[model samples]
Target: MVDASQFEKLTTVAKADGVQQLVVGAVVQHEGKVLLLQRPDDDFMGGIFELPSGKVDPGESLDDALRREVKEESFLDISAIREYIGSFDYESGSGKKSRQFNFSVDVRAAEPIELTEHDAYLWAPLHDDLPVTDAVKDVLQKYRELRAVRRD
Candidate 1:
């Protein structure tokens, strides 16, 4: 668990040193399919397909932020969120000048995605033809790997 002091220190360093810190994102799955959203026209990777995620707010746990972001963006309430699936660092096209940590989470179902937030949404089949961001591809690979192991 990341403590407040640790996060504060990280933030201080980010501002002072202009160094980017960790951000949290979610590769949320519902039913047998995973969720992906189109980045907004003004958003980084805008028009590109990507996982539903956002920056982790200060004093917020990764899981909490994941749930909150998913709910806010997708307009869906998720339960039984699993632990970290994987993380990748990237500079957001949003010009945040920071790195982001994307996590894979499992959910029973999403109520309904709020389309105003995104151009489109999809519940893509596992290992099937679907549009997704590179980051999402990494997370789904892990999801597929886990599922394959379970199948065996």
Candidate 2:
């Protein structure tokens, strides 16, 4: 379940912390691997891999932003927002201080992952050296710890 209060607390805290922009990322896991998307060399933060994420439009809920972003970037509908994987602050292309709230999510399907915004996609194994930014790497680490605890 999607909890509006939980999402509200996230935004509330971020605002208190003076975060200028809000973004949401999804960790879509399948077959022991998590999804990663490669940016186009010509785009912002190009030639780097990242989570399927996007900016949260004004007045939009964080959970809704996550679902919309995952769908927009990968054409994969989110089935569930499983867990909150914490967040990291960064400077976006527009030089705004942005904080991304990441979550573990389940998609409706695993096939025909049509890419709309990225040049390529990879199903990276959890233990490998992921070529993502430090922020994403940290989120994945927390995700790994959570998965381990759930299995025990």
- Measured on C-alpha atoms, candidate 1 has an lDDT of 0.67
CA deviation > 4 Å runs, candidate 2: none
User: For model 2, how does the per-residue alpha-carbon lDDT over 1-152 read when each residue is reduced to its tens digit?
Assistant: 55889999999999999999999999999999999999999999999999999999999999989999999999999999988999999898999999999999999897679999999999999999899988899899999999999999
**Candidate 1, 1-152: lDDT as tens digits:** 23455435544655585645456666677677877788777766678777777777767765667678888788776665554565565665555566555555656557556765788888887778668766667778886887687789
lDDT of each: 0.67, 0.94
